[model samples]
Target: MEQRKIPFVIRPRALGNAILVLVIGVLGLVMAHHPMLFSGFRRIQTDLRDTRLIHYLLEHGYLWVCGIPEHRTFWNPPIFYPVSNTAAYSDLLLSVGPVYWLWRAGGASPDLALAGWMISMSAVNYAAALVLFRKGLGFTWLPSASAGFLVAFGAPRVNQISHQQLLPCFYVLMTVFALARLFGGNPQRFWERGGLWLLAVLGGVLQFYSGFYLAWFLMLGIGFAVAAAILLPPCRTVFLEVVQRDLWVILTAGLVGVLLLLPLLNHYLPVARYLARRQYLPMYYAFNPHLWSWFHVGGNHWLWGWTAGREPFRTLGYPPEHLLGFGFITPLAGAAGLYFCRERPICRLAAAVTLSMWLATTFLPGKAIALVASGVAYYCLACLFREFNGPRERAFGLASVLALLVLVSFPNIYLQILTLSALMLCSLELVRTRGRPECQVVPGIALGLFCLKVFSLDVLLIGVCLVAPAAALIAYYWVGRRRDVGLGAVLLVVFFTAVTTILDSPNVYLGALAASSSALLVSAPRRLRPPAWLSVRALIVAMVLVVWFYDQDSLWLSFYNKIPGGIGIRAVGRIVLILLIPAALGLAALVQSLEQKQWTLAAWIVVLVCMLEQGVTTESFDAAANRATIAGVARQVTPGREAFYYRPWPNPGWNTYHLDAMWASLVTGVPTINGYSGYNPPGWDGFFAVDAQSTLDPRDVLAQWERAHGLPPERIQSIGLDRTCEGPQQTRHRP
Candidate 1:
């Protein structure tokens, strides 16, 4: 008798696990966000302004373009009436719109559809992450489920509930899973490879349509992954082989991706040209994450809520964007993973020394010079001991010794010869090593110290010390092989420790040099086992550390700000959403290991702690009340007008009314000049000026529109204000 095997069958245990995950996840979500879930979709989560904009976009704006036949074009949304391509001013929600529309078509109100869309997206994100971890990454059920929960409902993401555009992050996990499968192993069949490539491209396209921030982040993540694959010896061959075999497929996919992205680029490029890139002051002070942010849990958390609106957490304004805490259990587990792996002892030591030195330098004064001199001395000695394979090596050693002697002889020549010589030597080392991870660490550290001295920013050595070890640890743990630490790596540890003493940022160039130096310490090849100790677990810890130290208003961030699109990124802090993957995986691995070791109580305790840490309450506003307000304002619009502008009182109290006017336009199928969104239309300031006057003259309002947008006065007129609806603001439900 021949036995036939069935594919895609769910085992009883696996099915039970899946059901359990869903049960717990849904119960947790309902408990945490009860207001949002139980409001019958008559309430919205987060800020009223953004929630309304998102609702309008999903229900009316994008739907109209897709054949609903609204009065406005796809590009020109009703709000910000006269402005062209106003939809491009923010995320268009292209991927999420279809699902919302489905719900709406199935008899759901606009609010209900939006609410359902958010909850469903969260569930989908969880499912995608579960599959990625369980099937793609080959983790067991417990770890996969735990990680999925963190990825979908982590504290950081809960805090960002107002940002409806950021909700559709399932595409990111799907893209990662596809890329991993596509590159991690060889697929004999062409169709299989092609399918993976297509999936990857679609995931990326969907991610871009979902939100630009995540799209940019996905690109960065891919670049990092590719770079790691190339640098790590074991993965390099497979990566190269895949590239060679699938060159045509890769190129075709890229071309298709570009074609798909053209519409988005077309809309965004013009806006990018018109608006000035975000400046340093705004990015650094307002949008950049802080070191404390990663530990700053939201006030909605049951356990950590007490810390909210307090020191450290409340130091930075814009609590929603800044609440990036991944909770205590995740990081502790990550550290435990590193400790259990115990593969890169030297790398871990380097991290510890660097961190200690940074703390020492931060609190202590006048230790920087001594520490720096010691670092230079150690580098010279390491150069002396290093084997001279050729004349270039010998010459470099001689130059290093001479440079140290010169520094010792003339200490006051701070900004001249020594700084230049150190930089030149660092460049020479990079060239000599050809970017071999083991050989580049010492020179990089030396160069960073010299540059810090040159800038007279000895106190800022704290920044260099803090970032250097993190980069080194990440490079070594993720890419380096056993026994790969050489004279350079050894010298780097001492150099980092000594330089740390001087630690304490115009040293943007110094920070970048230091980061590059430390980051270049990739050595040897990663082990080739399925669950290699130093593979995923170590990588997660390293990445979390990188985000912790560099995501803030630090030198690394300053360097990032100089990149072409970097300035345009309003919320670099949002990178936490991506970090949720590694954080969740780390927690899962820890729990899985604990359970395997028969430490059942510990595993349960860890899981409970994570659940509590990730728990959060959401704010919901009365959409029904706002809809009534919109209806009241809609009746005020005159018939047969191309557009009507509403002028609410120029005060914070009347802000909601201004938003209502935009909503009224949607209801009446007429364009309204009143608008609210990410980017203001050109000459919007003039419109505000006109509104501030005591009179409500149509000509004056039309003239202001004409002066700002150059829209023809005959095409638009002003509508009378609805003073009858002037009452207290709508009630909000908070849980």
Candidate 2:
């Protein structure tokens, strides 16, 4: 076989990579979350929800390791006073164990530790992206560095700085890179790569514990890589070698995660399993594409306001979608990879995983429908086989098995079903029709079922779904038939308008359809003369931009609603981050324009324009924005004391100020009755009911508290003026 010539071949050095990654991290911190480097990093305070909570958990974990027996187990975290295993109420998984200990060893304050972790993780994201592009895709340092910046500091991630746990996604990138290296070609010296494989699995395990949702996301990408490796003949031998060399690493990582999580499982398994079972459907619906567009960019990001004005973007104040934008040239590059890099198995695997993740993450219409259908089918099977006894039922019981699996292992259902169904469909079609056109009917029926299901739930998705595929087909044909540009433009407009008008949202389904269908078009017979080389790339970029634009509104919120002490940061950071997409697109234009020896200065002008726009729009969180100064009240309490709030600010359903009550517990290391989280311990409401209606009766209050917590009077304490008893002790206005 003739060796394929690769472009932009500058080999990256470790020192250069580290320096560039560090630069990206420093820039990320300065531009977005902590602009207080000059003032002092220690003073930077992020908002409550997860940031404060995560810090609290980290502090608790550190104290536990430093010989504080009460903090030994996160279960019954000296919060919500005697509420056992309340740490399970939030995803306080020990994934950040290393970060916690490192900060502890360094004697860093919780705030300082958090800031350091965030900045370092941002750098890790940049490095991982660089690895994926350079080592994985054979790209040179400059383009790879640009791509790294784009991925690591994109709008969605910038907005998630407050939700710190979700920020360290370099594991996903690293895992993808590892897979590329593993199966990119023949495994040269497979035995010697054990260390690399160990690092890969170690990254994966760390990701799994970091955040459950992000771990699942990474698993989805990994699933795609594995499927590609096994299914693609050219990669099969290397894949086997990789498995042979790395099996122990994979098992070791699994064992380590299990050991770390054992305590959590032993304490909260049944309760969590039950709660998840009850909340699964509602939670899924709340976050799914049916209620919200998958293309939703996010409401908190600054660019969201610039792209779509500050009207209420969501129907209700739903949490925004995760993907803000893919940067300008990303989709184009992905499409090009699919079209032009088929010969390289690594490129093919990377392209396939990236494309699939884009579609899946965006909740593309077909993918969503398939997901819903599979979920429905899974439950239906479980229900149908309910009467089967013992182990037999366990084999077919997807829901029950899933719950059990969560208790003992990390299992990703969404990826499993998606990958399995796709492979089955492809295999069946190949077997049944030998690649003939008639095999299309099988997928057509599946598509019909998906459409019917979505239509039943909401006709909007169906319309969007249908229009998206049609739009993709038109764009694909238009690429080959440039003479019919007018016709193609009209069709694109009609499809886009129909979906936008009907659904009142730009959706993922449409974009996914367009991209995948365009892939199919790559192999279609040529019916017309090709256009200018740059035109093809430009056309593809345009088509993808349309899709990217569709979801931008979903990225930022109206920010109209406000609760007591609710913190809302300005959208400047997100807006600046969004500009990175255009900047990257311009860079790509410059690179291409240089290659073509035309329009190079115009490309430079575009790049300059985007940078200028970002400079003007980029904003950082004010010190006061994230500050919750509960330290004055908290430090008054002595260590190992029981604390109670006198009618603590009633937690008005996610009212962030209520979180201040628990901040006292975290700081003082005192178990406090007043605390907050999504899943409160059982009897919490009844306990609150009594606490809220303050009637002066100490014995009654004590009895009620005892019953609520199932703990003795000595085990708890009423700190800072127990209002249940009217006296001078109640005179101190502690919070």
Candidate 3:
């Protein structure tokens, strides 16, 4: 092998690298204006109505936890209906545990309870992103940075914030990442960096408890692999052959979860069967791809918005697709990895996972489909970890393809620019496709079933997945970094930069970016050097402008327009604390390195632009918009009785406020007319379904609640919500 020169493609000039950091800092600034940050982070309204659901688990008394029925008070669960999912869901498991713990620890204040929920959700989301990026994308700084912003702040799962379902999904994403790391994260390490045997089992148990998707995912694919291995034997060798990596962990974890819930599951067997179903609304779940085009192209955020003013994405610091929590960039650089990656197994796995994710969204019902497909999101991030150190030939092809595809039909010009830039940077490395350990047959099969939309198969896959790891010795053989194969790095840069500039929002930073394009006018001027004074001066000015531009564009000032000095303080503080100005300054300095007409500078500028563009916001939530309108109506809950009535503005026996068996789940630690252990017993809907014509009788209400709920009196508290009754203290909840 002739000793060929390896140009430092990954290591841009010191100035250029500094610019990338600045751009990332600018993104951090953009994040400061996010809806979650300033909108007061209010809890969802539906959650507010079902107070008992949150409180019953607080464990003030043993009788309440046991499900003994109470009267008129909303101390019992609603009757289970075969038509819908009511009693159990993976999303509920993780939340229930945390809420219970928090309340028992004397943190029962509703405000505190809501805060804990949000914090936990945020942590889970971050953890999931970290796992997805580090393990799936091979652990690069950029992937990790982008993963945090992309996964937590991205547009796909907006409902996560609204519904509080994000935490469990985060847990699930983290589990997959951990598994990937253990199996093949480093060919250098045979297992995780530290032994994680006990941890793996615990994770498996949590995965099952958190969401039903994992269970269904496993059943679909893993079952086939095991059957093929046992019945065919021929394919057994094709999968993992190691003895230490077998099915024991998964089985053990699963058994633990089942045993833990055995008591609850058995006692409520009848109710369980009735409630073990879904609403099954196929038509209600339509995913129009055109919606993406509308959302991104309109550049205003929502699909043209119902109010129809200047769209939301247009005014924000970030783009609509990047932040509103909806769809995001299609495969992009990950598409290139399919052909260009040197770690063939990693590439193959990435392909399988990505395909599965795509299928999950297209085929499955409910939101879990998206969660299933995101399995590839982490895999793609892992692939981005590769860096350039070899031949630059085929390195940029996939990136080029992605850029071109986005340019052709991508509605938002900004997206085209960003996509092109992404593709360019992703192609900056030499990639190889070859051997690596950490492969497991179970996750692979589960991923496949996810795409196919076989919900039942998910569970079996987990079982098989746990066992497959046991079959292989699972050795690690990390590949050395490869350099780019024959390719022109500089030319690629200019082409992408020009594209992003043309496509992106016409903002002040862009103009500053354009003016700074002068720096690219002259690259590595070995013969003629521009004065150092000019570069530093331009850099300082650019940093200041970055901060000013962010504050002006954020328009959050508009919300606080009435408040004195809020905007001035927020903007000044943001410049230093937010980090956007620094990132932009860094990027602007790098642009100065390129010479005019030198397309290589174009490449540098374009990539910087892409990274910077990601930080921009589009629309935001209006704080003035009232959230609790629907659930705010007052419903009466007597302190010691089951009877209640509605009273917001003096209700005259109007049914505006209704109570239910499981109402406890929706109130402030007060027993409600709602809940469940098995299936909804019967007449669950009628608890809140009663007409005001009936007289409000405490004894009668307690009897009704007793019949409905499986709880006894002492455990239930008929706490106050509205003035349903005032005269006497009833003890219908007392045994």
Candidate 4:
């Protein structure tokens, strides 16, 4: 491949430009939140306010470092008394601990400290994106900068503001860069000896500290990459070479992160299991992706109203704010990026590997395989003995075998299997039938199966919309290359017929519209007679849309929508806006292709619009008065006094007192029973038992009180029960 010069004027190599990008990101975030930053009002992003758990974490870490005897271990804090190991509740030890200690020591308020730390992390995230794109990919400054901006302030970061785990994403980027060199055979700088292993280890460490969920996500990604290397001969050779050079570094770094997590795991496992038993499976399916949700413009933008209520999308984890995947242009940009990188075998392979890992992580393909295997085993057992006189036993057996094959096939592998199988069968038929027109029948059947496979999982959900564009791509390609049309045309016709049949059944009239639009693009190059690449580019974009459409797994297999009342279709629009990040990347590639100065500026302008309209950091936090009141109340409260909130905790959707308890605890240096955290302490139920009868019946309350105090029933009546756990207003909000 010939080396291409930087397409833009901006010198991406200059240290000053990188610094300027970072500065701009920081200043932009601060300016966006000027209402909270400039004023003395404390800033707490949306997620923090919803849980106030991080506030507790920051305060807990500070006192631990300060050597305050009572605050030494958050486990035995005055709040949530009897429930222990509060420190095990979150991924706070490394990410937020040090930052909180520094800011607290400097006399910043708890809310202010938290806000500052979050802002600072956002800046780091922005800078890291720039480094990954510019340094790792070797893109010119404009495209690299565009990628950086999208990543730093993109949907994932904005949606995960409360998570703290997702904020420190730079380490993950560094790790990816390392892997690119090791497996993708992407070149590294001369001074970068041992950099791959070092980055892998560092990314692991920081990822674990940043958030266990993201750490697991990263590990899964690494596992997939390793698996890919092992499967592909060329990639395997590269992997083996890297492994031989620094096997110990990889092992040691991985072990250190795991060893550090052992203590937290020991405490966290029981609670996780407990919650999993009740909520895991049901919640998992509930959060499945609704097909239409992907195209809806997110609520973050002013233009959201245009597509807001049109689709019913949903999620179980974060709201639409955090669930952003590639937005409306997912079909367009994803295809364009792939087409641009089509010549780079390694880049395509890496993308496929990463995407496969994400699918596996979200869908638990292993479990699906196991379930299918069990079903097949049962069928085989039945077939061996003829136990039941079922209708069409041969047909059942064939279907079962086919289902098993599909179940085990990974995402990209499935695409190859379908495409190759069609080609082989079609070619064999053509030879057997002596080049007769009937040879088309075999490929037609296979193409129909492919279409069926694409939509059978979720009738209209998951990449169903891609059918139109995909058909167009196939048709256009067939038209352009008449020599290959014999079998290809048969496949295209069969595929189109199958897709339109399904769409018509569901009354989805948009299929025809999509096909028409794609056809128009395919014809544009002929009519306008523009650049030679324009028509091909348009076809590629259409092809990408078609490929991506069938490539997606149905919502039934996804983890995001598992929980009951997860972000449902009504609220899923915003999450789809995240697609814009990749779309921006695609625009960069197009600009690079055009090599035009004006188009480059236009790309930057689009990024700026994304920042202004889609930005969420500004709206993440509540006003300063709330923080001030909580602080005031905390100061007046007696130090070392235990406190607990009412029966139920605050909800982001409804409740207003979410941050009150934690904020007061931080200010007063008192521990309280009413605390919100990811992990529910083992003894929480024992300490605050509330069955149906206890909340309403005085006698039941007394009985419960006596059990809690380990006292006789007569003594419970003598003690006033009303004072126990106090009213919500007095307990959570009082000074």
* After superposition, candidate 4 runs with Cα above 4 Å error: 1-43, 74-78, 184-195, 228-237, 244-249, 273-276, 280-282, 286-288, 292-297, 313-331, 353-613, 617-623, 628-659, 683-735
lDDT of 2 by residue, 1-735 (tens): 999888975556867866765665566556555454655763553455656677666677777778686687756677667666777666554666576578668987666676777777777777777677677655555456555666676555665556666677776666656655655533467453554565566666666556555655455446666876786677777788767866776677567656765765565465655464333333333343322232234433343434333333354223443334433334344345344545656555555554444443333344344344444333333232222222233232323322332343212333333223322332333344433545344433443332232223344455456556666677677776542443334334334433443354233334334333443244233332132232233333332233333323222121112211111112112222322322343344334434355654753454333222221122234334344446644644555545544232232233343455577666666666766664666555544455445564434554576776566655455443444444223223222
Candidate 1 has a TM-score of: 0.72
lDDT of 3 by residue, 1-735 (tens): 999998866556656645644455345433423444444544222233223233222232222443434312122222221222333421234423555455435644444454455445544555555556545545443434444444444333332233333223554454445545555543344344333433444454565554333423333223332443343333334335422354465455556656765644443344434443422222212221111222232232333233223444444332322222222322232244344442345344434443432322222232332222222221221222221221122123233333333333323223333333333333322122212212212222322322223113444455445533433222212123211211222223333343344444555335324322332233224333323333333323322222222222222222323332221121111111011111222222223223233556563444433343343233333222222332232233434443332223233222223322233223433334433331234454343333343455434554565555555545444432223544222222345
Per-candidate count of clashing residue pairs (backbone under 3 Å)? 7, 15, 152, 30
Q: RMSD, model 1, all Cα superposed?
A: 13.4
The candidates, ranked best first by TM-score, are: 1, 4, 2, 3
For every candidate structure, what is the RMSD over all alpha carbons to the true structure, in angstroms?
Answer: 13.4, 17.1, 23.8, 15.1
Give per-residue lDDT, candidate 3, residue 664. 27
lDDT for position 347 in model 4 = 48
lDDT of 4 by residue, 278-362 (tens): 4445443444434443333345534343444343533323344324443444335445665676555454455556455334323
> Which candidate has the highest TM-score of all?
1
Best by lDDT: 1
